[model samples]
Target: MAEGDGVVKSAGRVLGLLQVFAEHRRPMRVSEIAQAMGIPQSSTSMLLKTLTAMGYVSFDAEAKAFRPTLRVALLGAWLNEEFATEGSVDEMMVEMARATADAVILAVENGVWSEYIHVVQSEQDLRYALRPGTKRPLPATNLGRVLLAAKPDDEIERIVRRINAEAAAGDRRFDVATTLDAVHAIRRDGYSFAHNLISSGASVIALPMPVPPGYKPMAIGIGGPTDRLERGQEMILAEMRRLLSQYLGG
Candidate 1:
């Protein structure tokens, strides 16, 4: 393999390892981390040892578990002042989740996919478990469509075509014209909503978040069962709008 390819692969594994800790929010054994990352235990142990030596991760001998150190949290803490303040995106997501009793997700465009960077699980018993690091095709999800709405038509079409070109035969393919129409609707309406488009009996309502300069485009979404989301659409939209205006001033 090329040296650059190896570097990128290693970087992705480090980020994925950090994300596993973020998802579980607890110290994890080597076996647990390996299983979560779908990597070999030996590799996981080596990675953990490297991180420990770098002072980015800590290992507890008594518990035989590893956890990210404060240095890891400090790495990106200065990137966004808003994130360090009271009226943060994190706070808004929590409020939205509480108000709607549904899953709230913060997604960012990652290559041709929309990746959920943060997810507040629904309080409702019947809801699905949407975890952080979940990814979906950029042109095929409401959350993704809202992120795409921030881009120009030409870029959207290019991205759609690329997604189609790379997709396997059995995988879903996107129609450029159809995707453009959907993105246009999202732009006109200032939000996107879809029911049962990606998952059966599931609905998602999403709006583009105000991205800071030099930051990737992002969208915040609320998701739940179709019937419940449909019934509470108005209320949910109102809450979302209020929170966005209050916290993000958008």
Candidate 2:
């Protein structure tokens, strides 16, 4: 869909507007977008019309709104197995959850964001309920911090600033120096853990997976109530390393 030499170049803008659609909870009206983002109503209408016709969005003629379609998830699914390594990370996640009785998540950096692509819930009825495709801010959780800390310093600062802009001013537990020190420690020690950063009773421990040559593998985290993970984080960390190594090779 490349434009001619001198025609126009709003395709990027159109795609960006569609991305905005993915993050929203409810279908948006042209006026709602115009007021919310300062974009013009006619432009929004045109973009919505194009998106609806392309099957990326569904138009509610009765409600007069445009909603995202299943196409996006289908597109993402087509690429998951391509990116994931062939291993027992899934099996290890389940075993870890059962043995530790803690919820476990398989996460990987997807471009600028980190996604929880798989989950194994703890057996207890009180355990946290997590699902596939859970996305969260990278700086707000230990899982994000572990991945962020592994990035280059300049990149890490840029991400930190972005997270700060979206975060409340008073919520000031993390800063560059302290976070960098934490990252250094994780890299040296080969695992990351945190308690009560995202939820009060929640604790998390993450370890990097050995990915294939020329491909970045991923990191998986075990999370549950601090009371349980605290009593067993060290043991879980040990077992995960041994099991992951068996599949990935030590």
lDDT of 2 by residue, 1-250 (tens): 1234443658645545554553344788778765544567888788778877889888787898777888855666634354434344555666777766778887777655677767777778778666555677665667777777668888877777776766676754448776777778888888888678777887788887666656644677888777877788779888777767665564
Clashes per prediction?
A: 0, 0
Give residue 237's error in model 2 in angstroms.
0.7
What residue pairs clash in candidate 1, if any at all? none
| Candidate 2 C-alpha RMSD relative to the actual structure | 9.0
lDDT of each: 0.87, 0.70
Task: Give the top-scoring candidate (lDDT).
Answer: 1
State the lDDT at 211 in candidate 1: 68
The estimated TM-scores of all candidates read: 0.83, 0.60
What is candidate 1's TM-score against the reference? 0.83
How many angstroms is residue 171 displaced in model 1 relative to the true structure, after the best TM-score fit? Answer: 2.6
